[model samples]
Target chain A: MQEELIRKHRWFWAWADDREEAWLREMAQQGLHLGKAAPLGEYFFVRGEPRDDVYRLDYVPMSKKDEHYYQLFKDAGWEHVGEMMGWQYWRKLATDSQADEIFTDNDSKIQKYQRLLAILTIFLPVLIINVTNMGVFSLREKYPWIIGLQVFSIFLLVFYSVVLLRILFRIRMLRRR
Target chain B: MAGSDVRKYLPLTESTYYILVALSEPMHGYGVMQKVEKLSEGTVTIGPGTLYGAFGTLEKAGLIRMVKEEERRKSYLLTARGRAVLKEQITRLAIMNRNGQGLLGILD
Candidate 1:
């Protein structure tokens, strides 16, 4: 029964399988290189008792291809299961009520806070510079060195902002790791 | 460790050594961790981050490559260069063992 199932499955291509071997030979005979974009074969996952069976047919398209076999599966009435990164799996849900639950981690408060801080770091110094310059104009009436001091403050703020941004960017990259 | 002993592994870090040792077979990250722990008798414990970092470095250096990847796991295999490095490390360890035992002069 297992041998018959494997023989019937389209994904179970073997060198000894005359049909697949002939197909490969025909393609080669056409002077077309069997590039990495062809379907390698397919397989199914069936476990547990015969009465209560679960079937998951898996297909590997070429060495690193998927679109072709995916269309093939779709045409055969197989439902698409969620992919694991680039590796995809398809399953026909046994019943209407049965659904596979895939886990995904949502962004936490700490991550959100870090992102917010990163954005704030970008504009914080510009806001500081604007406020300090405004103060310089307003206080110039009473203080003679107000403009000079404000210019120095602007430079300091710019330097601080650059340093802060660098540090924040580094932290963000580290957090991503 | 002595300077000469440390200098033998110019590129491979301690973690890389542990990883290569673990990959003597095609083992996944968690399996590698378990093997390293067992081999060291619980002296070294590599966290996921550190182990991945070392793995990335070893892979980039062409000392290891992915053998297989299953659900939530990836197994690695050592390259020819990796095997050579492992051999050299073992030889160094053998020398160190002999030297220490010779110094002790204790009868087995």
Candidate 2:
């Protein structure tokens, strides 16, 4: 039989990885399994018989270059589905015990979100430079389109800042537990 | 030895304690996971993320070191410092258990 493939345009924020995992697991339950994931929320899934599969995403920026990283997960009964950016996609058979969580402890879960926050921090300076150097007021008359673009960029900068703060709060909350 | 230096890492978290105990003999990440589960009688199951992060933290703290690599699977063993920390944690737990057990008689 030929392979049936489907593409989905769903976007998830940095803090919504758990939601993404749940959505992928839900898709698997409906006989659609995630295949290749592209940037900008593009996901390719292959049609297959519905099965109980638990999907997990781990944010490990440095592990992409390490062979042992993938091997470790593979040895632990998780299949390396694919990677979107630095997030590693893994799937395992859902057992009756529901013990397939990628992070078993609050500290490790906090570390995962910290890694994400670190990445976003790296981009913050570049966005700030663009917003300041571009000078929306100066470009408002000569280059009106540039002003609109600047406003959109500022919006994105604010959005990311809020996300970064939320992740920080989450880490703090985890640490308090 | 730096007893005070290693004491901070003492009272190892349940996952870290199990991981350290499992690495008493050299073992890889997956091996550690399986051994921990077996040793804990399925009460403690360390996931990949927790295991990986634990390995890195332990290695950095000079408690564990990579002993060898087999087919890209890095095997780790507890260092002398690691063994000391584990012993200290076990001692603490033993004391706690004795006290708790004594109280159980009174409560009953």
DockQ (Cα-based) for each candidate: 0.01, 0.78
Q: Give the range of the ten consecutive residues with the poorest summed lDDT in model 1 chain A.
A: A100-109
Supply candidate 2's per-residue lDDT for A130. Answer: 84
Interface RMSD of 1: 14.3
Model 1, native contacts kept: 0.00
Clashes of each: 3, 0
Residue by residue across A44-76, what tens digits does model 2's lDDT show? 999989988999999878633588878888888
Q: Every model's Cα RMSD, please?
A: 20.3, 2.0
lDDT of 2 by residue, B1-108 (tens): 337977888678899999989999999999998898999999998888888888888999999999999898999999999998998898899989999998997896
lDDT (10s digit) by residue, model 1, range A1-177: 552221113442221223443443343344332222223453322232222112232223234343433443443344454332232344443332212111001122123234434544677767696766667685757665766666676787776666566546654654575
Model 1 chain B worst lDDT window (10 residues): B1-10
Instruction: Indicate which candidate wins on lDDT.
Output: 2
How does chain A of candidate 1 score by TM-score against the true chain A? 0.25
